[model samples]
Each structure stands twice: as C-alpha cells, then as structure tokens.
Target: MTTKNLLVELFVEELPPKALKALGEAFSTTLADSLKASGLATAHSAVTAFASPRRLGAHISAVRSQADDKPVSQKLMPVGVALDAAGQPTPALLKKLGALGFDAGAVPQLKRQPDGKTEALFLDVVVKGATLADGLQKALDEALARLPIPKVMQYQLADGWTSVNFVRPAHGLVALHGADLVPVQALGLTSGRETRGHRFEAAIDPVMLLDADHYARQLLEQGAVIASFADRHAEISRQLRAAAAREGLTPIDDAALLDEVTALVERPNVLLCRFEEEFLAVPQECLILTMKANQKYFPLLDAAGKLTNRFLVVSNISPADPSRVIEGNERVVRPRLADAKFFFDQDRKKTLASRVEGLAKVVYHGKLGTQGERVERVRAIARAIGERLGGTALAADADTAARLAKADLLTDMVGEFPELQGIMGGYYARADGLGETVADAIEDHYKPRFAGDQLPRNDVGIAVALADKLETLVGLFGIGQLPTGDKDPFALRRHALGVVRMLVERQLALDIDALIDTAVKTFGPLVADPARTVGLVVDFMFDRLAVSLRDQGYGAQEIDAVLSRRSSRVHEVPRALAAVRAFAALPEAASLAAANKRVGNILNKSDAPPAAAADPARFVEPQERALFDALQAASAPSAAAFERGDYTASLQALAVLKAPVDAFFDGVMVNADDPALKANRLALLASLHAAMNRVADLSKLAA
Candidate 1:
C-alpha cells in the first residue's frame, strides 16, 4: 500500500555520449520489466536520465513497497491403490498434503454434495512480506547484468578486492530509495548515498544525494551539467541558431550532426568562428564538406544560400578565452578547405563534356563492365522507357542525358568526393552548352538518393533513373549480390524502390520482365547465364513492388495473389487494383464470390475428370444450353476490354454469366449418368475459366 521513489546510477570513466543515450533507455525498460515480473505493483514513470562523459543516471517516480502476495494452490493426485487397504487417508496422500504447507490440525471438515463427488477441504496459509529495497535490488541487479557494455574490464579496490568487469573503470554506484541508501556490493561498488559532479568542472570530492530531485540539481550547480538530454539538446539548438544569426547566415540542418553534437558535449557552449572570405571561391559543397566531415563544425550559409566563410562551433567547456579555441579550430579547418579547392580546380582542367570518354576506365561493377559501357546500355533502355510513356519529343534528349549522366565520376572533384557525383555532372553539362533538359536530367537522375527523398521530375529523368537502377539490379543478380536482412551494401533496396516510384508516379506501361531481359542482354558476354539472371531480377522486382504497393494501402495477401499471376505486366497493377475495387462495389459481387467458392469446392470434391464442352448436342437441359450461350457472348467483350486494359469493363462483361451459370447449377445435375451430358457441363465451367483468365485469375480474390 506504500510507495517510494527509486534511483539507480552507474558511475564510471567517460562513456561515449551516444552509448549513454541508448543505455539510459535500456535501463528504464529492462528495470521496469524486472519489477513487473516480481509481481510488484509499481508506477515506473518520470524516468529521468542524464549522462556526462562520465556517468548515466535514471530516476523513477514511485515503486511499490512490496510485491503483491498470493496463495498458490496445488493439486495432488490421490496415491496408494485401495488407500492403505482400508479406503482411508493413505500415508502417500498425507505426506503430499503436508509438503504443500497444509496444516493438518486446521484442515476443514469434508462435505459431499452429489454422487461421485469427493469431499472438499482447505487449509489457510500466510506468506511472509518483503521490503521495497529487497525487491528493487534484485530487479536492478538482473537488469545490470544484461546491460550491454561494448567494452569492459576488471577493477581493483583499495581493500584488496576484485570487481565485476565493466567498460572503462568503475568509480562508484548510487542506489537510493527516498532518502535512504539501498546497499549493493556488485562490481566493487558500496551502495552509496552520493554521486559525482561533471568530470571537467566538479569542485567537491563527491556530491551527496539526499533525494532524487536534489541529487540532479546538485550535479548541475556544482559542475554546470544539464540532467535531461532533451533540455540540453534544445539549448544547444537555440545557441547555435543565435550564433549563426549574428552574421545573417543559417546553420545547415543535419539530424546526424545534431545527434553527434548532443553526445559530444554535456554543456554546449556555442561560439562563432570565421575563415578567410577567399575560401568562399571554392564551391559551396566543397566548403561545407570541409567543415562538416573534418572539423565537426556546423557550417553557416548567407541569406542567398551561399556558403559563408563563418561557422558555428559547439564546445563542451566554457573556457576563460573562447576566442583562442575559435582560432585553433579555424587553423585546423583552413587547410582542409584548401585541399578541396585544389581538387576542384584541378578537375576543371578537364571539362565534364570531355570526361564522358574517360568513364570507360571506371568500373561500375565487374559484371556491369565500365561506367562508359553502362552509359551505352542506359541510352537504349532510357529510349525504350521514354517511348513507352509517349515522350518521343524528348526521347533523343533523354538518350543524350543518359549517355553523360556518369561522366563526372571521371572528374577530379567527384573522384575526391563521390557524394557530388551527379551534381558536378550537371554543372559541367550546363557549362558545355547542353540544353536545359539534358543538363537537368544529368543531375536529376539521382534525385532519390535514399528512401523518403523526392523522385526524378521529368519523363527523361525518370526513364534514365530507372535504366541506371535496373542495370545495377540485373547485373548484381547475375553475379549474386542480392540483399539479405539489413545487409544491402550496394543500396539495392533503394534502387528497387526507385523503380517502384518511377512506375507508380510516371504511370508508364512497361513489361518489367522484358526490361530486365533487355538489361541482362546488354551485359552480353559479361553475364554467365541470361536465363537465370532474368528470373532472379524479375523475382527481386516483384518483391520490391509488393512492399511498395502494401505501403500504398493494399493488403499483403492481395499483393501476393496479383504478383504471382501477373508480375510480368507490372504496369497493369493499377488497372487490376481498380478492377478489384469495382468488383467489390457490385451488390451481387458478394453472392457471386460465394458462388465461385461453391464451384471450386465441388470441383475439388469430384472424383471424375472434368470433360470439355465443345459438343453442344450433348446438352440435355435448356439451362446448360443457356449457360453455353452466355459464355460465348461474354468472351468477345471481356477479351476486347481486357486487351485494351479496361479491367473494370472486363469485369462488367464477365458479370453477364452470373444469371445463366446460377440457373444451370440450380436446375441441372452436373454428375449425370449420361456421359455426353456430363462432359458438356464440365466444358461449360472450362469456358468460364478461359474468359476470366484473360484478365486475372479471379480465383485468387477473396470471397
């Protein structure tokens, strides 16, 4: 019925800030689970974690005083045949009941209520209570044992004692309940009522923790450390943006940088630093890369979005002279930018237009041959993709763009920094007097560099992007570089998604199998076996397409059915989805689906082989003749509509057979004694199959 606050802290040498953030969560979750398993009714809320380079601590709101006690019941099967030979309480039964804590003196009188019923009895038992500290300590110990310490080592204490292995050296441990210390001796730690302040700025030997709230405050006041990472992160962002605003420049928004910065400092001190303006003559990308990749500084940009010479650096310490730190950082970053500038200038000596021929030396992949060879394959594939979408006006231009898309890979600038691959190509292409469409395609072909990024814009760009990705996919599958769980080294998943986005967004009519075949064939002598490569590439695309469609709102089962029956005609998937939606819209569609199930059930149960129904003279009933007539009429319209990709209209035509087929099933017996009559009825079902198979195997749809 009573509750108390719980505090657990791990004190050690400096931990990587990232590890601390993750471990804080692990501690809260694992500890909560352990307490619940012990049957304690505790509200583990208000989890507060604060980590410096040295320690990680979490505080819980309230934990129950003791685990809820319940009387556990046991069933003992009666032993001893014939009950001691006198039908009495056998010695075996007495011993079994005694071992279960049932008091023999207090056993209740037995009573019988019905025939074949035995007497019922019970003995009252009470369980001992456990203290809050006992339960919490057990739970915390279990959780700590499982806490993943990426690195650990043994420690020695002054008392000539050895401690449990740990990452870095363990200094102390603090475990608290309200104002009391819960003693623990694991890992050479004496359960204490105190923890330390920030490693760099602590003035006292140790800060005493009287309570969870005061303990957190003392650490901050003594060492200038913030307890909660969320608050610290907000403060860092505020200061960095303010520092950037002083020069009318903006801080580049980077999630990875923000996360790394959060781990790099306990108390972030934002400062403005500048480089010589002459460095701005280097490309904006080159300047930013120098600051971000090398110095970990947040680059600032001018109002016009140009990279400024100034940057904002966040420091963990508030030094007496911040200007000195700024100058030291500037000295380190200047040389890096100069090197990038040198690479950029040297690369410009060879124009991107001239670099097109140089791609022949850069291998795209062993099986894919050289980048120059890939360009040739892409030129043909892009033209095919372009023509299929009715973009002939720009088809020639798309061919030109695809041919030069990877040309910049040969340039010195892109060679030094591969991230600027397509970007440098676009810049060079435009400078060489290429048309806007051609130059734009050279850049935009790599629009979706990752999942959730924007896709290529124009048809030309989309076509070329698809070509490049498909070639990679087919070539890799031919050589077996397919992805397994989380091991996509070549980013094949992104390429697959790019293909899905192109198909769904561009609305292009493409036979994916044919496209894969074209790409595989382009490999020519490079691919060992084209047939197996084509199948693997086709299957990969289907898997990726299934995932994409499910994300678009289709169920997995439906996607499997559609893909199995029509993966080759991938462009027809949208039409098929529409047909499915329309079939569901019909009021009679439900009943029709039921009828279809009945037909399949009957066919499955039938022992005799079904016969063809081409002989009309075998029809003994008028209903059978009516079914045949309707099937004939339905065939023409359905085939015509399906061929033109009008799936909804095709479904409407198939609906014409509903009445006649239902009449035949109701009036005539399919298993007739007459052989010809039985054969004709089976043929009628065969005709229905032929008609529906033209669109999709309707049998796979859910009833």
Candidate 2:
C-alpha cells in the first residue's frame, strides 16, 4: 500500500490575475474529481496551485497506486425460474437482470433459509483491477488537453506537431507520479519529472521534482517562483504592509488589487514611494483610484487618515538600488494622477445640470434608446417606488438625481475611464451647485459596485437605485438577455440581489412586484414586446430572490411554497419564509403537514368539494358540534395575527387547533353515513385549509 505524489505545473506567458485565481481552484477541484472517477482514492489526494502573472502550477498529494479490484456480486435466477406460473419470468425482473449482464451460471449464488420454501441464487463477478497508471494517465491527459481555460489558442507548427493552445502558450509541463514520470502528453508537453522555474530569473535547467514536500522547497530556493499563490500573496501583503507602516500610513485594503499583485510578482519585493503633498488636494477617491487602477500601487495614508503622499508598490525583481525603483514608480504614477486632475478641472467647468442635456446623444443601448430616455424612465420608476413606500412627496430629489445621474457617463472624465461612471457624475453634480443630497444620491446610487459593497443610505438613493436595477432587469429580460448559468452579460443577477438588499436592509416597504410592474410599464413603449416583459421580470427577480433567501438559511422547499403563490412582494416573502420556518419548528408541524396531505389526498380521491354546512337542526354528534365551535374561535386569532404579520402568533394559534383536529379525525368519520355529519366534517377540513393558506400552503412542504 504505497502512496505516490503527483505534480503538474504549466508555465505560460502572463495570464490575467483574475483568471489565474479562478483557474487554480477549478484545477484543484477538477483534479480531485478526475481522480475519484478514475477509481483511485488514496488516503488523500489534493491539488495545490501556485500562480503568478507568468505561470500556474498544481501539486497533488498521495495520488493512489493503481486502483484496487473490488468484489462485485450479481443476483441470478434461471430464466425458467424467474418466470411466473405463466412460464415467463416477471417482465420487470427479467428486463432489469438482463440489462445488468446477468447469466444463470455466472450470477451470484444464494441459498434458501431453514424454511426452505423459496429458491435463491447469486454470482460473484470478479472485475480485473486496472493499473493505477492506466486510469491516472487518461484523467491527467484529458484534464490537461481540455482544462477549464475559458480562453485558448492553437500553437502547433505544421507537419504533425502537437498544437493545442490554452490561456497562454504552454511552454513546459512537469508531471510526475511519485518519482516516475507519468506517460501523458498534451499541447506539445510530454509528462516528465523536470520543470522550469522563474521564467525570466532562473536558468532553464532540468530541475527534477521528486515529491510534494521536496518539490515546494526546490521551487522556493532555486526555482525562483513562489509556486503557492497563498504563500506568495501572504508575503506580498506582509512586505507591502510593513513598507506602508514605516511611512505612517495605512494600506488601502483592495482585495481585487491584492489578487492582481499576487499574479504580478514571483519573489515579491515591496517598496514605498511618494508623490508631491500638493497632489492630496485632489479628491481622496481620485488619488486612490489613479494609483490602484492606473499603477496598481497600494495607496498609503497617515495616522490622521489623510493621504501621506506615499504609496507601496510590489515589484517582481529586487532592483540594484531600491531607491531607484521607488523613484521610477513615482515617475510613472505622477502623470496618471495629473491626467485625472486635468479631467477633474475640465469637468467642473460645466455643471452637471447644464451637461444633463448631453445625455440625449449618449446611447445606453441601441435597442433601449438614449441615456436621456433611460434617465426619464428611471425617474418615473423611482417616483413610483417612492410613492409605494409612502414617501411620494419627499422623493422629489430622487427624481432630480435620476435625471442627471447618467450625465457624467457622457462627460470627458468618464469617457477617459468608464469605471468612474456614477462617481464622475457625483463630482459634476457637486460642481454644478446641486444640493449635497442630490450629489450624494448620485454617488451612492452605485455605491455597491459589486457583491458585499455598501448599499445606498438615503431613501432617495434607494429609490433611484431600485429604479436603475429594475429598468435594466426588465429591459434585458424583455429582449431575452436573462442570465443563464455564468453567462450574465449584463450582471442582471447582481442587480437583482441589489434590489433584494435595498428592500431588506433599508427596510423599504417596496412591493418588488409592484416596482417591477411599474418598471415594465415605464419601458413598455420602448421594449420590443410588452407582454413578455412582465412575466420575465417576475420570474427573474423571483429567481434572484430565491438565491438571496437561501443564502440567508431558508429552506428551498419553503421558498418554493411561498414563491409559488406568485406573491410579488419582496418584503412579504421574507416574512412568509419566516412563518414557514417557524411553522416547521413546531413539534406538531410535521404532523400538520401530513394531516394537510391527508386532507388533500381525501379531496383528490373524492374529487368533490365539501358538502354544504350541516343543518343545525340535523347536527347529531357532540364531537361535530365541538369541532364547529372550535373552528369559529380558531379562525379569529389566526386570521387577525396573519393580517398583522404576526406569523408566529398565527402558528401558535394553529397549534391550539391541532389537538381538536386530531381528536375530530380519530373519533369522527369524515364520510359518515348521515349526510348532516358528513357535511360538518368536510366543513372542518375546509376550515383548516383556509386558516393554513393565510400563512403558506403547508401542503406544499415536505412532511
């Protein structure tokens, strides 16, 4: 029972930082799955990846020896014996066994019990074990040849050369199982124990990787590339943080830039650089963005929390003089900030109000119309959402902000850098002498640029945000651009989640359905087809909301039951989901679900609605009378509680009826011979349905 370690490294030209991070994870998971499917489960198998802008490498551990043969058993019955008295085996049993490759003699042997009344048979079918290399090679080759590198190229010269391309040209590959090289080749790469290191810094020596532990150390000292992304990333952060701390400034925590930095260097060398103190006169955000977006430098600030004219940059190579490196980076960053400052100065010359008219020429989408038209639609929808939330009059600024929010998208500043979309608009709004509220709304409207980003704080901001998200969702879905799988071309999923957060976090009394309806109507004239837009909006948002709810610990079945009712209200779904969860928590809840199922079952079988209420004069059973009186009392508390959103109270009230329900079912026959008694029992079950339906259709939940 010897274990083998496998190492595979692909050195390539510089890859996009984001792509490298994702590929590392995908490679590891896919490798594990490939191993499992190959029937090679050793004590442990893991994929460890090392990524830089230049290369991506994976090291696997304890890759099992050839898969071991396992004993398999097959049940067998003679064709004649499998047949019934009709002289044929049971058709289902015969077909199943036949498809499983069963033969009478080859089948597993079975014996009769002491009773010896029935015959039995079985077969032990021994499968030949495969060499671990046999399975491992195929899995490795297929994974390497068709790895999940979304973008690839073809790189073969003519005349039978291996010519597959990936994220970048695969220069060299190191593949090994223990000390032996596994015989697999792809993309002109032949599996071997030798690997190349530090594409630019180290010699192209034939370095042999003998084992996982040894392999890591060799790559660290002689190979020159920190093959572990996690190790490299931590080292970069440590150096960057220390350098920034020496200058009495805090490093801006940018996860995106951190990832990029991880890809940019091998042996990270962090150095602090400074710009002119006067540059701090520019907006803090502008300076930070210029450094991060333009130069990929980590911005540093002083203890007073002000920009210190200092920044930290990580370099792959440790230069002869670190001072020279710092100066060189400063030289590059200075002009980028100057360009930003120039854009800021030029943009402030014209007020956002004056520039607002410029949106008419900016096409948002050729099919959806101009930015100006989109603004109008956003304003109208925001106003509608505001009114729905009981803030109709106070929402005036929201309308104004929505009208000018996209004005900056046409401004020279935004044109130079589209990432500054709403941000540039906010600056222009402030320069135009608009009130703080309007400018802030414009800025905060896009506050949450991505997942986990801060949401809008003001009602006006929330309204405009909702309007923007809904319009995009409805417009795209109307044109059939809905997100499928990872292909969210328009980021519709993020937008939908934004709407959900707005309602839940801001506690906005928004009926998502109503807002979606308003959005659909506002775009009705613009959309190619109006009828499909409404349904698309509803289904799309429900899907996004379902994901959001599930992340919040809601059961899928409960979400399904609540959403199945087609409740357009976002605020209510959470409440309904809460009620369903609480109802489920009841000791009697499972029994109640089962009870409702029984009721549904009986109704389906009867295929008839309950009979008319029993005539009081003909009411003959004491149990029936008690059930009727209890139903009247139970309906009051549950109905009142449900109306007030007191779902807990409603469920508690329902619990009071569980006892009576069980007793009535046990002591009383629902289909009694007496028509009067039968009607009363039917009325009782119908009453339960009405009460339960207020919270959720409990029957839809699994018992």
Candidate 3:
C-alpha cells in the first residue's frame, strides 16, 4: 500500500502555560506509538510535534492508509478434550468448529502443539487489516485518554446538554492525510483542515490548512503564530539575549522561566522594560523573585551578577511603536516591588531576638512540637557538632545562628514569600549588627535544597545545615512518617542526601552513626522510639548514599565492596572507593579476590573463632611457610599506609602475596585431620583476611 504523511490538531482555549510543553510531547508520542503498534506507521516513520497557546498538533510521515494482514495462530482446545477414544470428532469439537464457521472437513488441516503441559489443537488464519479511518480514530482516542493532564474541565457541547471532559473546552479538530481529510471524531467535533491561531495578531481567523505537509508553513505565514514549541522557545531566548546584550548586561539563566514564557505567547515579541532604579535598593533575590514569580519577567544582571533596573518582557504582540507595552509592564510591576520594599523596611524595625518568641505559635508538625522546639533541637545538635569539629568559638557561632535561623519564619517578608525564610533571616542578621559569620550561617542553613546544588560555604554553615537536616530526618522517622514509594511529603530523601553530601564532601571527622545519635539525643523525650529510629535513620542515609554514588557513575560491584564494611566514618568512602578501583586493575587481582573469598568461607564454616595466632613452628608445608613469611613482611608498610590514609597504597602493598595465597590453597587443606594443625591454618587465613580487607572487602570483588 502507498503511504502518505498525516497531520492532526486540536484547537482550544489558552492552555495552562506550565503544562503546555509536557502535554504536547505526551499527545504526539502517544499518538505515534498507537499508530505504530497498529501497523499503520512503520518504525522508520518521522514524527513532529507542534504546540502553542491555543493548539496541540502532531505530524507523522510515512503513514499507511491500511495496515497489512497478519497470520495468527489460534489455539482451539486440548487434544484430549477435542477428540473421542477412537480419534473421531466429538460433540464438543463439532460445536467449537461450528462456532468458528468451520465443519469437520477442516480438522485434517489443524495442527497439534504443546501448550504448557498438554497437547493442544491450533488453527491458523489471517486477520483482516484496519482502514485508516478506524485506526486513526482509535489512535486519537488513546492519545487523549493518556494525556498527563493535572486537571480537566467538563463543559456542554453546542447540542443542548451533551457534555465532555477535557483539559480545556475543545473548539475544533483537524486531521488530514496528504491532501484529504480523515474522518475522526473527538469532543463532539469532526476532523477538518481548519484551525484557529494567534487570537490578536492572526491575519486570518479559523486559518485554512491546505494539506498535511503545509500545516506549519501555512500557520506561520497567514496565522501570525509560531506553532512549534521548541522553535518558539529558541526564538524568544535569542531575542532576550540580543536585547540584553545591547545594554551590556546578561539575562538571568532560568530554563523554567523561559519555558513558561514560550508557552504564554504564540508569536513572541521580546521587548526591553525597566522598573525604577530605587527598587534596586532591595536584595536582588527579593526583586528577582517578585519580577519572575509575580510578573513572569526576566531580570537582567551585571557582570558581577548584580541585579539591574532593566528587565525583559516577552509580549505576544509586536506593534510598530512598542513604548506602550513596555510602559504597561513597568507600571504593573512597580506596586509589587513597592509592597516588597515595605515588607523589608517594616521587618527591620524589630530584631531577630524579638521575633524568636513568635515561633512558638507556628506548628511544625502535629506529632512534633512547634518550630521553637525544633530550633532548640537544631541548636543543640549544631553546637555539639561544632565542638567536635572546631572548639568553643565555632560552637558559640553555630549555636547563635541555629537559634535565630527560624526567626525569619515570623517576619513580614517571609510571611509574604515562604521561600525566602532563610534568606530574610540572613538580611535581618546583618542589619542587627551580627557578624558575617553568623549571617552567612543563617543564610546557608538551607543549602543543597536539591540535587547538584552547592553545599554550605563554611564550617559554621555546614554544622547548622547538618543539624537542620538531621533533625528533620530523625524526627520524621521516629514518628513513623517515613517516605514510601514516591510520596515524600517532607522530602526526606533530599534531607538525607544533603547530609550525605556534607559529610562526604567536607570530609568531616564526625561519624554518620554518631551524628544520628546526637540528633536523636537532642530531641530527648520527643522521640518515641530512639533506638529503632536510629537504626532506621542510619539505613535510610546509606540508601541515599548508594543512590548518590550511582549517579556519579560508579558500578554496583565497586560500591558493594566498600559499603559492605558499613564504616561509620562516611567521609572516608570516596578514598576507599578509589583504593578498591585501583586494586581491581592489577594482573593478580582475580586470583587474590577468589582466594580471599575462599578463605572467608573457610573461616565462617568453623564452629568457633581460632584460638591462637599462626606459629611458624607448626608450619610443615613449604607453601604454608612461604605465605606466612610473605604476610609478615607486607604487614608493616600496608599498616603504615593505612594509618596515613593512603588507602590505595595500603591495598597495593598486599598484592605481593597473590602467588603465595594461590599456592597455599592448592598445596594445603585448611581442615586437617589433626585439630591443632587445623586451628593453626585457620588462624593464618584469618590474619591474611584482616590485612587484605582493611580498605575494602576483597571478597565482594569475587564473581
């Protein structure tokens, strides 16, 4: 059958901007997949997706008008049930054949095949092909049903009380194959070669599409719209940069903001707009957040990344004289900025100390107490960790920062913008004459809010951040509010990951187990079950660490080798992993790894621990004595290297015993006839195992 390109579109009212891109992708992909599965499109067919503020469309190349017939094997029934004792047809067989429009004459052509454990009779037949009309209808219905719409609306059609549910009220449907329209219905509308475009700037309303291949071109030339989402996004990005470049400034790099702007416009016209320079007096974060979140604008930055008075607006319409558009946006944004400034100024009148008492009224969690109680717990944990890392001075700074960290939760600025809790606290700290160390600590306590985000910049910040995350994790786990599947209401995974990054990246001397203990102890009587909760929290942190390691490109075996030890000192994990990777590359590594596994198996099968160390006087075989001497000689340098944290060198120093280990295993049996000799050999193997696995368990490297 000859094939033709196909195009389909659904035109509607303005879509939700944040979900437009995803909706377009899901619609086009699901449609293409359904067509391919039904054999109406081949594997090599090309699919293009088009989306804008008013429409979603898909264009697929090399689609067939009819799918080819396929031969199918149909299992009739078990042979035992289909035939009589003499192998003649029975009533059951005759009834089954009759239902299939067949007679006894067709039995001679039937094939017998094994089905599970019984022989079954099968009939071979050709299934009819589907026409383009039926196939396209099914594909369109599947695509609409599978769309990832967050919410749907139910509205009545033009016919009195008949209603349909969709993401939005559909106004039209377009489906075309080559130059002809395909008959398909959706949302009480039939397919046509007509779609509406840019409501204001379109040169033609209800734009007439000529053919499947001319949809995009016709829409662009006559409809005054850029139909492709990606093309529109790239065009807006280019214009924003070009406009910003002329002023010697750079636009803020926010992909999400760019995407939302692209979804808000059908024909993008980037224009430069500005707010009063006086607005720059506020912190750039507040100004940028207000402009981007409240007004959907992009704030420009100087070379030093300082916020500028001028910003860019992506307007849907482009007129000859654009001053009015710029003025209109500026006028709308000024009051928002003024409100932010008012909040900031009024908040500074009272100190953080005064606001600290107000936290008692704010509930953190029902099971857990108020934010005030949580702050006290964080302060205790932070001070304890600080004292371990630095001394009294660091502890004092961390304690002070932790106490006031949540004070901003009561500030007017933070009340207006909950995302600015920590940020506003830092500003208030600076204005209150607190040192930069305390201010930075308060600001950075929420560091690493997501994956790939930076950790705290200083020791004080690290201490407080660690305390805050630990408190959340332990408190939630204690109350049985652990994350299950994907429902992480409190983002416990992120908190656990934040703890992992700080400990590993900072190379802190504190142990993961010890830190959990500290956080639990600080909660005092609040934690319901500290012992069980500590175990759960520890396991949770390790799981997060494994995920983090995998994301960094380490293989499973290498991770298992090091993590099997379950070392409390998580800071040493990276160096330990590096050591194991180096050791696995040696020529004798396979033999040594296997031998280490064998030795471990031998030691574990014994009834009890070896009573004494291996003695040279009891060594009767030459290979056994050779292995003992080699281990004695290699012990010093390996021990010295491990003491100084040279994990790679420590593991490498023991590679010299590979030959002796192989020979000793081959020449001697660990379980000898004599009890004393057996104990001696087991002791010798135990010594070798200890020295080899100091960095990582070599047995884990065995296949």
By lDDT, the best candidate is 3
| Backbone clashes, each candidate | 3, 14, 0
Per-residue lDDT of model 3, residues 1-703, tens digit only: 8999999999998899999999999999989999999999999999999989889999999999999999998899999999889988788988999998899998988899999999999988887788889999999999999999989999999997998999999999999999989999999999998988778788888789999999998888889999999999999999999999999999999999999999999999989998889988898899999999999999999999999999999999999999999999999999999999999999999999898888889999998999999999999999999999899999999999999999999988888999898988999999999989999999999998998898888899999999999999999998899999999999999999999999999899898899999999987787878999999999999999999999999889889999989999999999999999999999878889999999999999998798557988998899989999999999899999999999999999999999999899889988999998999999999999999999999998999
Per-residue lDDT tens digits for candidate 2, residues 1-703, read: 6767777666677777767787776665666667777667553566677666666566777776677677775555544465568744466555566676754432234332222455544446677566656766676566665556777776663446556657777666666676777666656666666776675566435566775557778877777778788998899889888887776678998898999888777788888788888777667778888789878999887777777788898988776788888889999998988887888888888778787788888788878888888888999987887676656564687888898888887667788888888877777787778877788889888756677899886777878888898888888887777788789889888888888887777766666666877888887666777767777777777788888878888887798878777765567777787888888888888777777777767666654677545444555666666767776788899889988988777866776667766777777777778765676667667767767777777877854
**Sort by TM-score, best first: what order?**
3, 2, 1
Q: Which stretches of candidate 2 lie over 4 Å from their true place?
A: 1-4, 24-43, 53-56, 63-139, 156-164, 175-186, 189-195, 199-213, 302-307, 390-392, 447-449, 527-532, 598-618, 667-684
- lDDT against the true structure, per candidate, is 0.74, 0.74, 0.93
lDDT by residue (tens digit), candidate 1, 1-703 = 7666777777777776556667666766677667666655354455666555666667776666676676643334432321456646555556656786543442333222222354333333445455666766776777667777666667676677655566667777888777777766556677787777766776664888777657677777875677666667888899988888777789999877776677677778998988889888777887787688767899987788878778999888888889898888888888888898788777767766687788788887766688888889888888877777656866787788898898888877787778888877877787788867877788889867876788876778888888888888887878888899989998888898888777766676688888888888877877888999988877777788888888889866456546767556677887777786677567656655556656666666667756654577777789878988888888888888988889889877878677887798899997788776766676677666667645555566645
Return the clash pairs for model 1, or none: 14-53, 152-166, 613-683
lDDT of 3: 0.93
Cα deviation of 488, candidate 1, in Å: 3.3
Better of 2 and 3 by lDDT: 3
Overlapping backbone residue pairs in candidate 1 total 3
Off by over 4 Å in 1: 17-20, 41-46, 49-52, 73-138, 145-168, 200-205, 240-250, 301-310, 318-328, 352-416, 431-438, 597-664, 671-679, 687-698
Model 3 misses residue 522 by how many Å? 0.9
TM-score of every candidate relative to the true structure: 0.81, 0.83, 0.98
